[model samples]
Target: MNHLIRIIAISFVLMPPVFAQKLVDPAAVAPEYRDAAEHRRTEQLRQRACSLKAQQAKILLRDRAAFVLKCMDAADASK
Candidate 1:
């Protein structure tokens, strides 16, 4: 009876491992789902880049305007 109990206990411990091995691999995910995920990632990167570019452009424009205004003020003061 002790041997039978040990066998049952060992099987109980090993059974979950056998079940875990049946899981689907991530690489084997559906092609359409994978492609959609990739597309979303690309779109997110593109949007981030575009937003940063726009912010940089705004800063450049503001600096140019400030420099031009400073030059005009100097000219007015000289007159």
Candidate 2:
């Protein structure tokens, strides 16, 4: 009863995270769309760079998203 409930709760808590999106493989895409795939890869790199900057700056979790968004926008605007 109680033991079973505890085990269930523990299992749920320990479960690995599941990502909703799958990574795009550029090689798997058609040659015509390779440019689009490259763009996606570049955006992913930009996002990872922003995330690293946020972590290095020790941004609060609440403000980190906004910070990243602003960073990305700034990057795009400069292009």
Candidate 3:
């Protein structure tokens, strides 16, 4: 139908947003790391740990956010 074609065309024109990875602060980043030469080191370590855990567990893509959040929480608690 013409209407269906028009709707599809509109949908194609209004494309879904692309996702980008942004830098995030570590939940438990130490004060020492804040002013260090490598300020992002703590967050980077947390991110690396989270990534390793996710990969080791073969976590689903949709569940990565929750898993990373919980992992950060645990890391924070350890401090």
Best by lDDT: 2
Which of candidates 1 and 2 is the stronger one according to TM-score? 2
Q: What TM-score does structure 3 among the candidates reach?
A: 0.52
lDDT of 1 by residue, 1-79 (tens): 9999999999898885433223234356687687666666655554545545556666575465555455445555787
Using TM-score as the yardstick, the better of models 2 and 3 is 2
TM-score of 2: 0.71
lDDT scores of the candidates, listed in order: 0.59, 0.91, 0.80
Model 2 steric clash total? 0
User: What value does the lDDT take at residue 75 in candidate 3?
Assistant: 88
Clashes of 1: 0
Give a tens-digit lDDT track for model 3, residues 1-79: 9999999999999999987565545445566654652556667778778978998999998998899989989988999
Error of 3 at 54 (Å): 0.8
Note the clash tally of each candidate. Answer: 0, 0, 0
Off by over 4 Å in 2: 13-23
